[model samples]
Target: MYRERASRVVGGAVVWESVSDGVAPVRVLPDGCVDLLWSSRRGLLVAGPDRTAHLSVSGPGERWVGLRLPPGAAPAVLGVPADELRDRRAPLADLWGPSAAAPAERAAAGRPAAVLESLARDRLRAAGGADPLGARLTARLATGVPVAAAAAEVGLGARALHRRCRHLFGYGPKTLARILRMRRALDLARAGVPLAEAAARAGYADQAHLTRDVRDLAGLPPATLLLG
Candidate 1:
C-alpha cells in the first residue's frame, strides 16, 4: 500500500509505503520535484527530478518513506544546483558528508516521514531558503502563461530566466512549462476527461500536441498510461 499526505512542517508531501508479497512496479513521472527518501534497507537518499518516466522495482516486505519537496525547494535546502542532480539519485551522506547520518538516525528511531520533514525544515531554515520568485514562476507557468510573460512577471529577462530555471529546476523555462502542461493534461485525463478535451483544457494546441508531449515526457502514449 502507498499513502501520502501534505506535511505542514516541511510544506510538501510525506509519503509512506508498505510492500506486500510481490515486487511492485513503480512509475515515477516527472513533475520537476525532488525527494528525500529513507528506507529500512537504503537508509537516506535523494531522488532528483526526472525528464521522463523512471521505472523502479520494489521488493516484497520493504518499507519506504519520503518527503517530496516542491520544485524550487531542493536547490535552496540541499545547497546544490538542481541541475547537478537531474535524473540522479544519490546517498545523502555522499552529498552532505558524515553529518548526514543525523537524519538517518532519526529515521531509525521509527518515524521516517517525520524525520524527513525535520531534515527539510532544518535545511531550509539554515539556507534562508527557497526563492519566492521561483515559486511564483512555477505558478505562472502552471496557469498556461507564456514563458516570456512568466519571466517578465518575475522581473527576469529571457536569458536570465533560463539561467535561473537551470539552477533551480534543472531545466529551462520552456522545458518546465512543457512538463507542467503535461502533468496538467495527465491529471485531467486521469480524472476521466476525454483526451482531446483534456488537451485543450491543459493548453495544448491540439490532441496530437498533447499526445506527443505526453510520450516525450512520460515514456508512454496516453492510452497506455490510462489503461495501466
Candidate 2:
C-alpha cells in the first residue's frame, strides 16, 4: 500500500509511506524533487532528482517512509550540490556522518513521518532556509515558460542560469522545463483530460509530442501511466 500527505514543515513537500507486498516493482518517475527516505529495512537514505524513470525493488512487507523535498530546496538542507546526488540514492550517514544517525534512531521508535519532518525543519533552519531561487525557478518553469524567458524573468543570463540549475536542480534549465512540462501533462491526464488536450494544455506540440516526452522520462506512454 502507498499513501502520501503534504508536509507541514516543508513547502511543496510531501510525506509518503509505502508498504511493499512483493507484487511488482515500482516505477518512480521524474518529479524534479529529492527525497529523504527511511525504510524499515534499510534505514535512512536520500533519493536524488532523476532525469528519467527509476525502478524500485523491495522485499515483501517492507515499510518505507519518505520526506520529499521540492526542487532547489534539498541542496541547502543536504549541504551538497543537487548535481552530485542526481540519479543516486545515498545513505544519510554518508552525507552528515554521525549526526544523520540520530533521526533514523528516533524514527525507528515510531511516528516516523513526524520524526522526519522535525529533522527537515531543524536542518532547514540551520541552513538558513531552502534556496528561494529554487522556488522562483520552479514556479516560473511550471507555468510552461520557455527556458530563456524563465531565466530572463529570474534575472539570470544563459550560462548563469545553467550553472545555478545544475547546483540547485541537478539539470540544466531546458531539461528542467521538459520534465516539468511532462509532469504537467500527466497531471492533466490524471484529471481525466484526454491525452490530446492534456498535451496541448501542458505545452507539448501535440499528443505525439507528449508520448515521446513521457516515454523519454517515464519509460511509458501517457495511457499506461493513467491506467495505473
Candidate 3:
C-alpha cells in the first residue's frame, strides 16, 4: 500500500496544507483568491485565480486546471500589479480550490485514506483541458538547460517566450527556472544526499544559492523541509 503524508501551516490569516504520496491528488478549497503551485514530479504547475484545486485521480502525473485572466486582470484578482502576480503569494485555498480543506479535515479525523482517494477521483473528473503552453513549458524544463537556450531550442524568440510563459504560467522564464531548480534540489535533498552535493547536482551556483531559492519558493529553510 502506498503511504501518504501531509503538513499544515496555521497562525496567519491564511491556512495552508499540502498532501503528498499515495495515488490520489488532493483537492484544494476555493476561498476566493489566487494561488501559486509547483509540481515536483514533472516540473509542471499553474498559478492563477480559481475557486477550487482539483487533481487527476487516474494517474500521478502533475496536472492542474483553472481560470486565469490575462495579465491585465492580475491586479483585480490578486491585489498586485500584473508583473507582481508571477512571484506573489496569495491565499492557498483561494488559489487552489475548496476541496483542499477536505483532506486536512479527514487526516485530522483519522479517516481512512481511501476517502481522500475518492475525492481526488471526483476532482480529476472535473479538471478539464491540457494547457498546451504548459505542456510545452514542462517539456523544455525537463531538459535542464537555461531558459534562453531552451527558448531557442523550442523556436520561440526571447520576447515571444516571455509573453507565452507569462500567459500560461503567470511567471516569466526566470521565475519558473527558480521554481524548478528548487524542486530539483528538494528531490535531491530527500534522497539522503549532502546539501552541497545536492545543490551542485541540481545546478545551483552553490549551497547558499540553493538555500535562498528554497526559502523563496517554499517559504521555509531547506533543512527544515528537506531534512525533517
Query: Over the stretch 34-101, how does candidate 3's per-residue lDDT look in tens digits?
Result: 33232233221234422122333423443322232222233333333334344333433454466455
Best by TM-score: 2
Q: Which one wins by TM-score: 1 or 2?
A: 2
Q: Per-residue alpha-carbon lDDT of model 2 for 87-204, expressed as tens digits?
A: 9988999989999878889988898889888988888999999989999999999999899898889899999999999999999989989999999999998888999999999998
Per-residue lDDT of 22 in model 3: 48
Error of 3 at 196 (Å): 0.8
| lDDT of each candidate versus the true structure | 0.84, 0.92, 0.48
Residue-by-residue lDDT tens digits, candidate 1, 8-122: 6445445555554455677788998888888777889888788888876666766778788888778877888999889988899888998998778989889887788777888
- Every model's Cα RMSD, please? 1.5, 0.9, 12.6
Model 3 off-target regions past 4 Å? 1-129
Q: Each model's TM-score? A: 0.94, 0.97, 0.49
What stretches of model 1 exceed 4 Å from their correct place?
Answer: 10-24
Residue 40 miss distance in model 3 (angstroms): 26
Ordering by TM-score? 2, 1, 3
